[model samples]
Target chain A: MAIFVNADTKVIVQGLTGGQGKYHGLRNQAYGTQVVGGVTPGKGGTDVEGIPVFNSVAEAVAATGATASFIAVPPKAASAAILEAAAAGIGFIVCITEGIPAQDEAKVYNTLVRDYPNTRLLGPNCPGIISPGKCNIGITAGEIAELPSASGPNVGIVSRSGTLTYQALYELKQRGIGVSTCVGIGGDPVPGTNFIDCLKEFQADPETHAIIMIGEIGGSAEEEAAEFIKANVTKPMSAYIAGVTAPEGKKMGHAGAITSGGKGTAQGKMDALRAAGVKVGLNPTEAGDLMAEIVATLK
Target chain B: MDLFEYQGKQYFARYDIPVSPGDVAYTVDEAVAAAEMAGYPVVVKAQVQVGGRGKAGGIKLADNADEVRLHAGNILGMDIKGHLVKRVWVEHASDISKEYYASYSLDRAAKKHLLMLSAEGGVEIETVAVENPDAIVLLHIDPVDGISLDVARDAAVRAKIDAEAVEGVADMLVKLYRCFTEGDCDLAEINPLILRPDGGVHALDAKVSLDNNAGFRHPEWEAFRATEELDEREQLARTHDLQYIGLDGTVGIIANGAGLAMSTLDVVNQVGGTAANFLDIGGGANADMMAAALGVINFDENVKSIFINIFGGITRGEEVAKGIVEAMGRVELRAPIVIRLDGTNAEQGREILANAGIPESKLTSKPTMLEAARAAVALANGN
Candidate 1:
């Protein structure tokens, strides 16, 4: 069984009255997510597209035993929303907002670990995870996925970026490849799950034969995850490191893309993954084919 | 993201922290008036966001009104770490007997709320740790429990502060913690928490960075944000909702995707020419957006050439070309432009730009980041 969001995952939307919140909530409901309830402070009595609304996450959880929450609230209220979900016993929280202060994120992350030990946090800025042909918990371009192959479903993608995941998946679909699941762990300086955390889940899933890890220009998470893959993961894996040419001492793309001081360069990540015996694709276009070749060889 | 010292002091005062009385002044006469009102021996601090101002001669002690005027005149036009000082902050100078430091911020690497306390704090704490590693004490406060009095006391002892100051420091630390969390601050640093000869602690310096993500809650922060300090080009870009960062290079960049735009910078560096700036118009880059992007780059004196790299997904290539054409019609191009388009409607987009009288070589219809980078660098370097 896939970890995190799957077929049976019941979802609740926080900030459902907002534009983006309503748009994505409706999409998730259409895709068969059991979006049982929503939370909007003043608009508690109203319903969004047939979904019940409540003043708080706890009240919503009490009415409907929602297991997961999709947080679309602004950054300031996001941490409070996560805490609210945690207090309500929602097992999973996926935050889609970006631009959260590093201090607030740290506080939320630490609280999740210490106060709610059993709760799993997906992202504060990520697109969230998608169990293909099932349900999507966060914002990812679902149109990028190709139909299932005649022989077997092959690739699994774990990326630090959300938009890059869509681009990578688009390129993969061009070659008629399908993903078992694509997890966007987010590119914040401190993400809820590290690269290894997602890799561990991917490696354990029997349906995911090969994995493509798409990383950006910053952080030692990819390098550290490579070591774990070598020791623990038995699945064939390939990687594509983005932002290979990022300038020194600049936050080029995402706020998290800046290496702070060259601590997590693309070359550093690529070399580490390669040295760990993982096939590293030079670019996103070649990643799917490289993983396909590796899977073919393994067979 | 960084707030000026005066702004940070204002934030601290709002949180009930004991900050010295200060008034920010933009003119030399205003500085003298503020200093006179603050009384003699006032401190005239240059209003720049970066630290080490005291070392840069930005912070000066004025014994009288004449000294205040002299220091303010010298500081108003001074440059500190790429920021030109346009204002002075006049404050009542305290008699500092002992200096200690306290800060609350998130340690991103450790994924914890960090409290840094040090006894040797008047100088740069980073330097002190590099030279005397034992002078600073760091505490990782658990997010659930937050910073408690016990943790603050332990940090105080580790920082080598006196026993008499421990309880007081602990109390201040607790309030600072509340300020840090409630303020939605990325960092709240009080360097040189002065132990006055009268036996009380005062925050001599305040460095606070609010989280932009939390801005939805703090609407009042908009007034405190000094937009005047931003470069004219950057300010214009912000007005147009573009993400642009100016750099010291000849090749001006305009890219569709943020990831691709960043990779283009790497390729530019690989080919030996520096990137003038980063301009990501997002998926919404159209003819108008392109014009704004070009105008931003053109505003920079260092930009010798323009490079447009777009890998159209949600953004249409032909529309981008039209935007460039439209922008060209309005703002006179100080430098030549190189356009590279790929993905959806890429070939047609190239055709639109080429038909508009731009040279075929300048309007590249390539998909590779390396190819576009090399071409742009060659054109920019005139090689």
Candidate 2:
């Protein structure tokens, strides 16, 4: 079975009254993600087209029994919305809003771990997760994903970068390789779910034959993930670390994507992955192709 | 947003964390007056963000106003590690009996607040980490329970802090932890948290990085924001709300998503061309943002050819194509552009470019990212 999400997962959209929330929320519904309800404080007892709207996450959870949440609230209120979802016992939460301050996420992360250990938060600035043909969450285009088939191998993917996740999927799709699940962990400095968390799930999934990981500069997450891969993951994996040519001390768009004081360099991450028996790709396409080779050998 | 020494002290003061009494001076005369106000035998330190200022001769002691003027005049306008010192912090000197280290930063792997306390201080913490890892006491604090006096005291004692100064250091540690959490600081570091001859713990240096995302809550942060130094390209990009980092190269690069932009830079470099800047349009690859990004890159004279790489996800391909075609009309280009357009509805995007009537001399589209990189590099070399 696919990890984190499947066809049976009931989902609620937080801030469904807003522009982004409504758009991606409805899009996810179209992809058959079982979008059960929406949450907007003042706009309760209403429905966005067909989806029921509620005053709070607790009401939405109680009424529809929605087990997952898609949060599209503004960055300032993102943490509060996430905490609300966790409090209401939404097992999985996906936040698509970017630009939430790092401190807000750090505090929210600690709160989630302490109070709601069962609640798994995906991202505050990520593309969210996609299990092709089965379910779609967040902003990842469902049309780009391919299901398990006779002609393609079902590989699992996890990445820190948004568009690079899409690139990896597209790269493999062109080569007739399908993905069992694609998870974008986001580029925020303090993400709720990291590489190790996602890797653990992918490793246990029987349908996921190979793994494709995309990481960028900044933080020791990738280096740590490399260490985890060496001991745990038996599946063939290919990885790509962006920002090989990026200079020191420059924040390259993402809050977490930067080389500060000679730490978190792309070369350092690449070296760590290579030493861990991971086939590290020099660039995005090379990384995708390397994964394709593993898939071909798998089936 | 790294706070200067004076600003860091002021930030620490808000949380009742003790820091040296200091004032920031922009001129030599202001520095002399600040020195006089701080009392005799003051220290004049450069207000640059980079470290190793003491080794760079940017820090010195001034026992009198004349010495203050001399030190300030020498340090001001002096370049240390590519950063020009426009201001100096004047503070009263302290007699230190012992030096220690204490800080709070996010441990991403642990998903908790990392408290690092060490008896060894007044130097780079990285060195202490490599040389004597056990000398540093690492504590992971949960934001829910928070840090109490007992927790701070326990960590202080375990860190091998001097027994006489343990209480004072622990008290300061509690306050420092508040500055890290409640203050919305990404990192609140006190290097050489000094134990004075009187057995008092004082912050000799404050290195703080305020979380930029928490700007909505901190209005006073504008004072620090105003003094941020920006170069030509950086300043221009700021006006457009585009993420751009200026680099020393010839091929000006623009792409959607941070990862793609960085990978674009790597691909350009791999093909034997250097990128002049790193520009990520994010989700807004629309007409207005594209023109704004193009204007910023064209402002750089070193740019020989522009590489516009777009891999659409939530960012639509046709919209980016129309933006590029429309942006090309608004701004006069100095360098030819090579576009590697793919992803969602990319076929429609390619169709729009082919029929746009924009001559090939100005815009050239490639089939793949690799081909586009090669084309951009080749065009940059005038081949």
lDDT of each candidate versus the true structure? 0.79, 0.90
Once fitted onto the true fold, the runs of candidate 1 whose alpha carbons sit more than 4 angstroms away are: A1-3, A7-18, A22-69, A73-90, A101-104, A114-116, A146-153, A174-178, A217-220, A223-231, A234-237, A240-250, A261-296, B250-260, B267-274, B282-383
lDDT score for residue B40 of model 2: 84
Q: What is the lDDT, from 0 to 100, of the residue A262 in candidate 1?
A: 55
**Candidate 1 local lDDT, residue A154:** 65
Per-candidate iRMSD:
3.5, 1.4
What tens-digit string does per-residue lDDT give for candidate 2 at B1-383?
88888888999999898877779999999998898788988999999988899999999998998999899999999999999999999999988999999999988777778899999999899999999999999999876677999999999999999999899999999999888877888899999899999888999999999887788888999898887777878988987889999999999999999988999999999989999999999963676788789999999999999999988776778888888887788878899999988776788989998999989998999977888999999989889
Q: Candidate 1 residues B1-383, lDDT tens each?
A: 67888888888887788988779999999998898788778999998877778899998999988898889999999999988898889999999888998898776667878888998888877788789888888888877678788888888988898777777788889889888888888789999887877778879888887766567778878877644366788888988978887777889998865666775675677678889888888754677888788888888887777878776644677889898888778878777777667655677788888799866644554555556677778878988
- What DockQ class does candidate 2 belong to? medium
Query: TM-score, each model?
Result: 0.82, 0.96
Lowest summed lDDT across 10 adjacent residues in model 2 chain B is found at B283-292
| Residue A175 displacement (Å), model 2 | 0.8
User: Model 2, which residues run further than 4 Å from truth?
Assistant: A150-152, B345-348
In model 1, which residue pairs have backbone atoms overlapping below 3 Å? Answer: A245-B266, B287-B323
Q: What is the fnat value (0 to 1) for candidate 2?
A: 0.79
- TM-score of candidate 1's A chain against the true A chain: 0.95
